[model samples]
Target: MNARIRGIFEDAGVRGWMHAVSLDEPEASVELDADAVVPMASVYKLPLLAGFCRLVDLGELDPRERVTLEPSARTAGPTGLSAFADPVTLSLRDLALSMATVSDNASADALLDIVGLRRLAEILESFGLRRTWVRRGTAANLRDLQRRTGVDDPDAALAVLADNDRTDPVGVYEAANASAASARDLTLLLRRLWAGELLSASQTEFVKTTMHRQVFLNRLASGFPHDGVRVAGKTGTFGALRHEAGVVTLPGGAAFAIAVFTHAARGDFRQPRVDAAIGEAARVAVDVLR
Candidate 1:
């Protein structure tokens, strides 16, 4: 199973790590380079959401509290509230929903400001995820990208990333300031969440439901199309990195937490093969545990 999974990544021309563990029996698991640190991209939103939910649970935050954001206040992104031209008012709960469901940069930045990086760090520590963290918010990440590449435009920065001969890819990747995690740590986090160890039962259900509403499905979900199986996933993509982490639940109440992180050999932004490999690799890992 490990060789087959490694072959999927090799065939896709990318470095990959994966871990899948059965929720019904956590001892049943599969892994490959699961402890290697990798860029998490937008996958940080998962922990951010958990932190925000924790605040709500502690009575420290009012989910119904309304905030108005101008168009300029939003982080630069292609989707959701970030793409809007007019000022918008939203409840804190809706902002989190937008962040989780649509990967809304604007909403994420807003929530991060409210939750604060210190609080997020505390949340990860509480969950025993020593290697996972949010170094900075999305806006800071984009600014760092421009600063490091000497390119004011995102497209130009991406072009710099694509030129391996002229640029140090590792330096560029580090400059992105994305969240970081390992497959083992992420999978363990999910397993604990599913086991009701990270959050209360109701809050855990909220997190799972938010993940279930994710609109992006080209990665892990593509591999498991069985009608009886339900996937609740979060996807992250930046530069040559693509990742998806989530729980797949079978009809008989059996579930597995899977995390697949990959970095392509080339910097093409639209690599369907890499995306397919993510799903295929995750499917193989899940099958082994099943």
Candidate 2:
């Protein structure tokens, strides 16, 4: 089964790491380099969201507390409050929603500021997710990229990382310098999440609902496009890496928590084959677990 999954990844021009376990029967699983730590990219928001919801449940933070994000204070990104010219005010819960559904960096960093990075690390440690580490939010990551490349412009620094001739000084593709996680750890987190062990019932539902509403579905959702088969996933991308980790629920009620992380052989911006391979590999893993 591992060999078959690897073949799918190779055919798609990427190296893959995956872990899938039956939520209904946790004993059943499939893994391929699932324990190796790799960069989390936007998927770092997963644990961030968890910590946010946990705080809300604990009453340490109010979900409905509204805050206005000035343009200068917001992190630049392609979506959400970052794209808005005027100052935008929203409740903390709505910010979390935007972060999860659209991978909004501005919303994520804002939430990170509210929920300290140290607290997130503490939360993961408490959960016994030792191999998963979220070192910083997206803004910090981009800043490091700029500093590493000695480029003032974020986009130019990103392009330098994309250049095959240059070795990435920021090491964004590796586990150490950025937020990183093992597939096993991520799947375990998801298992507990789906089991309502991570947050209050309402908060768990909020996280699940937010993830289910993710706008980008070409990766994991492509494999489970059949009617009534719902996929609640979060995708991560950085340079050559592309990943999606989430729970897949079948129409018959069987569910699996799967995490598929890949690094492509090439650095092309658009790799539809790699994206589809994520879904296809996930389908295969889920089928085996089923």
Candidate 3:
């Protein structure tokens, strides 16, 4: 398993680590410097969503409650709520869907505002995520936006990110303000969710289903066939750092959580090797469980 995973990383020119864990056997797990902290990139959104759900659970916010998106609230890029017709109005449920399904920055920022980052931090503490730090800044979502713009430039793209400093006050964030997570904790989070210990089964199912909509699959999801093997994950990338972490459910109800972080050559965040390493690590978890 290590050899296969190593080959994938070597092929991708990724310099980092991989961790794997199987749900069928709680005591068994794999680590490759899994304790190391790494920037979360957009993977921070999972905690954000979990925090929002906690709010809903507490009756502080209503999932069906309607909210407005002011022009000022309108940040741009792959987000549904942000790019929707100006002054868009939607329920919290819709907004969360937009944020998770597309990694929508506007939806994320709005939710962060509603949920509050400090409270989110507290929630992570309760969940036992020590290194994961999404605190507060600008275009922290830049990796995705940058990739999108480089491939799909527009008249309004560059200026928006250039003004990312406005994101915190205006509701954007830089990667630094976001928290970091280790490969091990990330896998533990996934394993717990799949085992129905992270949240209520319904809540866990919501997260798992929501993550399945991730449109960008060049990383971990690219490693395995989408059929019998299911990869439900969140990805994070900044500069040359590439990270993808989540649960992989294989045939016969076995599941494993794996997180892979890679440092790559400039402009190689999308390299296939890093992605393959993530896949191989997940495959290892499945093998162990079987």
Candidate 4:
């Protein structure tokens, strides 16, 4: 698998770097700049969702707490949750579904509003990740833009962002200047969740179920299907970065965590090099562990 994945990196033009690790089998691995911090993109949403579920475990917020999705909460992106649905209210749990299952930008954005970015950053820190950050957009770019206006509005930055690109939280703000983590850290996260350790047992189950319901239909899911292999993962994409991190339970009951991150700038995501690299890495992970 390592040789295959290595070949894939070369064949696919994985530009700046690549890295992968296994949770169930510690000895299985591959890397390039394994310690480097690149843009995380949507992968940050995983930690954010886990942190929110953690809050629920503490009884601080009800998973089913009802909230209304006003028009302002919507954003343009690939999502069934944020789409043409009329003004509707849903429980926090349902909102989480949108954020995870369908990659709904509005749902993810609104969840950030509810969970707060500081808490998410702290959650990763508590989980022993040294390089992960969930920075707020306002903290990232607001003060300079707000100069002379003598006004501070957190919502102002979020409103104009992508409606115009920038943020105060997770709401489509270019991830606040490159939030990132190593494949090793991401694998650790998946391993923990697979073991029902990230949140309370029930919430952990919810997280797992949400992962199983992922709608992307590509990446590791399509590439690594082997009869009963169950994939539960999160993928992130941005300029120069494409990543997928998750746990796979093989047909033989062996489970492993695999994460692949690349910094390919020239290749369109659909390019053979990109898919071949990702597919090859996952294929290697399966062979080593399963």
Candidate 5:
């Protein structure tokens, strides 16, 4: 099974790290380099979401509080308020919704500001996720990328990233310097999230619903196309790195938590084969666990 999954990743021009476990019985599992720390990319938003919910549960934050984000002040990104030309106003909870559903960088950075980096680290520690940590938000990360590439523009930095010969950008691909986690740690987070042990019922449901509504379906969701098989995942992408970690529920009520992180051989912006392989490898691992 391991060999087969490796072949699938290799065929897609990527090397992968994966972990799939029965949510109800975590001991029943499948793994390959699951301990390897990799860049979290947008997947870091998962922990950010948890921190947001935690603050709400603690009465430290009001989810319905409105925030006005000016276009000039927002983070740079391809989606959400980051792409909009005009200022946008939304409730904290609605911002969280945008962050989860669209992997919106602007929304996420706003949430990060509300939930400080130190507090977020404490939340992760509370969850016993020692291997996971978000060092900074998207805006800081992009600035770091630009500085490393000696480019004034984020787009030029991205162009430099496309060159395979360039060094790994610190806050983008280097696990130690970026938002990063191991596959096993990610699966554990999903397991705990599904268990509803740390969060209130309403917040848990809110997160689950937001995750289920995520717009991108080319990675993990691609593996399970059946109407009866429900998949809720968060994907991450940076240069050659692509990842998705989520929970999959079968029609029979059996559930599994899986995390697949890959580093592709090429840095092309659109690597459909690598995306499909993420799903395929996940399906294979889940099959073995089943």
Candidate 6:
């Protein structure tokens, strides 16, 4: 790791790990505590997307199938269909797209219902990702927050998080049956996906193209702003944790699968410093690999 990169993370008072490997030369890479397990937050959606694609490839599920869901039946979140007050109907492919492009909670849970949690795990195991798993959906995470804080509402639970009171919010965040993964494991998953080892060609393209449409670009994308370098990433944010994992493709046909995960020393939801650190850390790792 670069000294400046180490300083960037150290100064932010956050625990971070990064792993980057080039698609053209998988053996060439950089790692900093890459094996450390951290809360994946929405980063779990990447694997869920893959699992959904696998089902599509196997003819077990149809991406064109339409499903309807009401707000009450879906997970509570502030984006996409989750934020709508009325019932919304969409194709399974569009739902997966919403989950990847906007990190839509409702879309994720709806797709999770179709893909099944056990099937998602089976897909990851087939890819050799032993340390990654999603215990439940986003709605279950919200319920866990309510249970831990003794608050029955999502806004109240968030207020609890913002106030930074009631012992060990981080502990509660980690203890919740949310998804989890190690940085190394996430990077490897991306590697396999890019190497044409995870899904069929068309299915893999669907996953990659959806990732390219992600609306959040403050983390991994912030690091690489060059004209021809394209970044397709998914970000995860909850409590003191912020993570972004995806593949960064350069103009020369070189691509690096990178995963950056962080937990702030101070549990502040508005901490921009930690977010910037994530970008800087990933920038350093990508530079080294490049």
The global C-alpha lDDT for each of the candidates, from Candidate 1 onward, is 0.85, 0.90, 0.68, 0.66, 0.89, 0.84
Q: Write one digit per residue (lDDT tens) for candidate 5, span 128-160.
A: 898998998888888888888789998788778
TM-score per model over all chains: 0.95, 0.96, 0.80, 0.80, 0.97, 0.95
lDDT-superior candidate, 1 or 6? 1
Put down candidate 4 lDDT per residue, 66-91, tens digits, no spaces: 98877655654446555756777899
In model 2, state the lDDT of residue 100.
93
Tell me the spans in candidate 6 whose CA falls farther than 4 Å from its real position.
Answer: 2-4, 164-166
**RMSD list, candidates in order:** 1.8, 1.3, 6.0, 6.2, 1.4, 1.7
Compose the digit string of candidate 1's lDDT tens values, residues 106-160.
9999999999999889988988997787888778877777787888986677677
Candidate 3: list runs displaced more than 4 Å.
1-3, 82-85, 137-177, 268-273
Better of 4 and 6 by lDDT: 6
lDDT, candidate 2, at 133: 91
Error of 4 at 202 (Å): 0.6
After superposing candidate 1 on the true structure, give the runs of residues whose Cα lies further than 4 Å from its correct spot.
162-170, 175-177
- Candidate 6 Cα deviation (angstroms), residue 221: 0.6
Q: Ten consecutive residues with minimal summed lDDT in candidate 5? A: 164-173
lDDT, candidate 3, 184-270, per-residue tens:
877776776677675766677787888877776776666676677777787765545678877777767777777888766434324
Of models 3 and 5, which has the larger lDDT?
5
Q: lDDT at 39 for candidate 2?
A: 91
- What is the TM-score (0 to 1) of candidate 5? 0.97
Error of 2 at 133 (Å): 0.8
**Candidate 5 Cα misplacement greater than 4 A, ranges:** 164-172
lDDT of model 4 at residue 1? 42
